[model samples]
Target: MAGERVSLDDALSNVDVLDDLPLSDQQPMVEAQSCSVVYTANFDTNFEDRNAYVTGIAKYMEEAATHAELNKLLEEGEQHAVMLYTWRCCSRAIPQPKSNEQPNRVEIYEKTVKVLSEEVKKLTKFMKFQHKAIEVFCNQVKRLCHQEKRKDFVSEAYLLTLGKFINMFAVLDELKNMKSSVKNDYSTYRRAAQFLKVLSDTQSLQESQNLSMFLATQNKVRDSLKEKLQTIGAHEELLCEVVNISVHMFENKMYLTPKEKQMLVKVMGFGLFLIDSDGCNINKLDQKKKIRIDKIDKIFKNLEVVPLFGDMQIAPFNYIKRSKNFDAKLWPLCSASTISPQASLMCHLPRIREEHIKYISDLARYSNEVITTYKETARTDAENRDISDLAQRGLMLLSDWTSVVTEVYSWKLLHPTDHHANKTCPIDAEEYERATRYNYSPDEKFGLIEVIAMIKGLQVLMARMEIVFLDSIRKNIYQELQDFVQLTLRDPLRKAVKNKKELLRSILVSVRETSADWIKGYEPSEDPALKGKKDPDQGGFEIKVRRRNVGSEELELSLYVPPGPSSTQLYMVRTMLESLISDKSGGKKTLRKEMDGQHLVLIDEFHKTSFIWSYLLNFSGRHAPCPCNFPNWHGHVRRTTCLYPNRHGHVRRTTCDVPRACTLTGTGMCDVPRTCTLTGTGMCDVPRTCTLTGMGTCDVPRTCTLTGTGMCDVPVPVP
Candidate 1:
């Protein structure tokens, strides 16, 4: 028995332990096992009784064991023992069969052992590969962390190393879950094998005992793999340290350059993509899983990470073309040709530059500070220092800068501009002076500081105008004056004026032009005849009439007339009278009338002794009133000179009664009858008579009827 026990030990010792094999080999091994079972079950047995059948099986087994083709099975020592034990169990499990029956229990049991061995081999291979891969990843992370220099922070090697580390986290997680599944499957296989061993006969039981010991060895190997995975997982602290160091380098604004910051942002974006690929939320992760960098965490929360394809495995270094959340201004630090396919994709995302991020941040800070300073200045009624310290640090978007200008303009409009006043505006003279003292680029300095200065200076001028002019006069021209000052004067001067002296000189020039008599005495015409003319007295007191050639069939007279006498007209008449009176020599009173379709009649000279009048009239009586109300009796006429005729056939002229006031207080020389020739009432009133050479006579009575053309026309009275 002791010799038999020793022989059994030797057999168990020679049994090859299940080892790792490639996954491709597993299916073929399973198929081979199935074929072996089928061939063994179908083996011919020409015996009449159970003993003969048993004897026949023994002879077949003995011959099969010694066969040269089965030499490999003999070399598989413990495998033979397992096969023998399985055959014994199969013999007891199966009932006695008829002569024609084919027994398959032994074949099935032998196939079971082969399948179990294959599973063990696969599980072992998986565990070993995972363990080695994890160790390599951890060591590589350490090497990369050590090799990284401040200058090489944005280098491709460093960034790719970081990406590998991120990938390691996912691999480690998969390893743990795989380990659990292997353990469960092994437990089930071991339970079934133990049950079969218990039911075996004495010699078969002895042979099957080693199977339990082999399974124990497999359990020990699995346990060791588990311990190793745990050891690798414990290195999370090392990963945390690397991440923290990187974040610290990024946050070190005083030392790192803009290029480095931009690269760091890209690296963080890549890490975020890896995390998202694993179905984990950075912000909402558990404490153990969190990256633990406050700034990085904040950035992750603030910026969105949208993947082009949901299952994409690559990073976005060269793949992404645009991304608002990630800074890519200094991206492709390495050559684009050097980028590997595994690291990039052909996709687009919104992006911004690191410089732009800083600019926006600084702009937001400056805007808040300026607004606060404005509130303080308003509350304290004291001059405050300039709040433009952050303005020189970076450049901002033009749209954002325009908003600041608009805010400052609004504040100036609401509050008083005077620094000495009890209720003052946000920006005062002292603040403006200090703000302007600093040298700034065109974007910030001109866009914000100088723009605010122009607004403040213009506000002061407007306040002075408010004090000097009447409320009614200001009401008519205040809005137009503001727009004119901004567009024509303030904007041009802002570009040209450099120094305070220049600015003040420009402001003085603006004051002179804005405070002229024409601007200050401006009023909206109440006369219906001057409604459509846009600022007729804006530049000078001159009437402009444009003539266009028209077809005879569509011919119509175009007449422009003022509703009532205006200061502009009075000014023109005054200049004419002055020119006439300035000549001391007596002149002849000549009457000359031009009868062309376009030219106006001219009376060369008029003396008090004798009056001579020349009149020319052109008319076309066709078409209805124009949509612009031009043909209505009470409608306004644009760009036309007015001449009034009295009952005695003498032209009436107006004189400026108020001298330089130039108000519409002048009176006409004649007391013309206010009666319309067409309606014989006061519907359209004017005093003139015109004759169209070929068509008919058009009479302009005190109140005349409207014609197809805007001119006053009436049928000639039969004499």
Candidate 2:
């Protein structure tokens, strides 16, 4: 019995020594004694359902010291363990023919035996390597327990190494099942072959020589591998002891409370379980499980749990921190952790505003460049690709800018009260206005107002870009370019222009109303009865002005007066519109040419409104009233006459067609004679124009004009 292996039945009969031991000790002894039964258990049983047999054994080896030589041995041991497990898996995948069934050809049996021989040779080498590796690993574990520093022993790296050891058991178990399958298949084939008498004496001799030798070698390798795995299982208690000692060491060093130490152990155990159960590559794991592993990994790496080792306490918004020297220019590029202080955001409003302005300006310029290069021309494949890339970059930049602005806005919202005084929270518009007025002196509320307007305009542009990209799939680059110019560029510019017009009108009315008291002082003395009465002129002027101003300001400041916030906003709006329109590539001219009749009318109206605003702002009795002139679509100068109330308060309206050479006199009268040209039937033959007239009437005969008596008229045939 010296060289004989102990059978499972014989081992069971010899369990008397475990009988006197405690139940806990008896249990592991019984499991170890029944290792063969566990190894041959049905595959349906969970592999991870093992008891703490190893942990119990590892307890007694906690004080063993490791030698320097064991380090190299342990490393080589882990490598061999991995190779051995891989070979065992490969060996299991080799097909075994059924022994009870006769093969259609003798070639099948010969091939199976040949493959078995080759595998046996390879497995023998791996088994030798693994045998040495296991010895070294066990010795290392013993020495590791006696070492003072056990922190590295409990690291993820070493835990992974231990996981390879546990995997060896599963490999051996699977190999046993595979061996059983091979035996059953071969037995069936042998019986059928013998019954059929399918081989000659010489063939039978050759088959026995090759097949029997291979079977013997395979059984030897498998037995050796199983014994090696059992050796590891026998040291399971020592491994657990090492882990326990290391955890205690870590607990003291980390200053963890008893509960915290327990939590750490539990987390470490979970991580080790995952490493043991699943292979090393976490990317191949199920999504939810992978996410859990990642979170736990962060917890371990950063030690982000409560009661950290030092005096560091978690900040309220610790997820994002602001740097002391936060730069607004670099804000868009800064990491989330360095760009979130409310005070920093408030302090950098001006620079941030400038950055946004510059971005919009650049986007506009780039858009024009895109149009000039790609529009109205056929493009090669490379050109088209380039265009697409540029467009995508523009969209990406826009998205980043929008996100940064939104984040800044969110921070503002979170800390709505001003930090200086800690006042009650204000609405977004009010807060923006107050910040602007305080930070940007002289310009008052306009600085922030312009920024908000630009943000809105950019938002509109972003929306248009989205549409352009979506449509670009079905449409050519040219069509998309046209769409960009029309919707993204021109549309926002039109809105800004309209807004400026309204703002200008409001400022003019406000200034007039505020200076009404001054106007009243210049008026002649009224009779005692009419002293308390309101002036008819005042009512008319106020009514006419009120009809012109439209829309409410988003931020209404009490201190907002003429030429302050309103004028600044108007100037800003005008500047942005001009920058977009002044493309060096003649895109502005091209845009005008492609515009529809409505857009042309808007341009005309804008110019006319600008003229009226300028005239009113500089109006004085010393200067004579002159007609406002602006170029028409044909590049011809068209004059519009202005009429002022005379001393007697008389006013008149008239129609006239003055030549280009005509001029208006100091009395608000046209100095040139008006000529009418008519085709045969005497119709006016031209579109009639309207002009304001003074108190006097034209004495020239057959000329249409306004008079105090009535209106001058020339009869003509109806169309």
Whole-model Cα lDDT per candidate?
A: 0.30, 0.34
Q: Which stretches of candidate 2 lie over 4 Å from their true place?
A: 1-107, 143-241, 245-719
lDDT tens digits, residues 1-719, model 1?
A: 55655567676656643334346431211010011221111111211122322212232223222232222322332232222222111122212223334576444444444445555554444444435544554454444334232111122123334443343333233233323434443544444455445336776455334433433343333233324433342233333434554555555431112223333444454344333212233343324555643466443322222121111112223222322233333233322334222111111001212434454554455445544654311211011111111221211122222223332322232222343432222343333222222212234323343333322332232223221122212222222233332323332233233333342233323332332234224422341212222333656333221111112432341121111112222222222222223221122321111111111111112111011000000000000011111111111222222334555556555321111110122221111222344445432233324443333323333222333343322323322
Weakest 10 consecutive residues of candidate 2 by summed lDDT: 621-630
Total clashing pairs in model 2: 15
Q: Model 2 misses residue 49 by how many Å?
A: 43
Model 2 TM-score, 2 decimals: 0.19
User: Residue-wise lDDT of candidate 2 within 1-719, one digit each (tens)?
Assistant: 79999989889878966776666321111011111221211211111212212221121112111222333454554453443333312222324344646564456555435444444444444445545655655555544444342322232224334433433332332343334433443443444345445444986657644544443354343344334434332233334433333354343333112222323433343223322211232222324342233333333323222211111112211211222222233222222333334223345456656766666775576466645665433233344334444444433333333323333333333333443443332333344323322222323223333433444555455434433332232123223222322222333333434445443233222322222222234322342111323335543212111101122441242122222112222222222222222221122242333434465465444423332222122222101111110011111122333232333445434443332332222222222223333222211213222222322332222333333233334322222
**Candidate 2 lDDT score at position 54:** 26
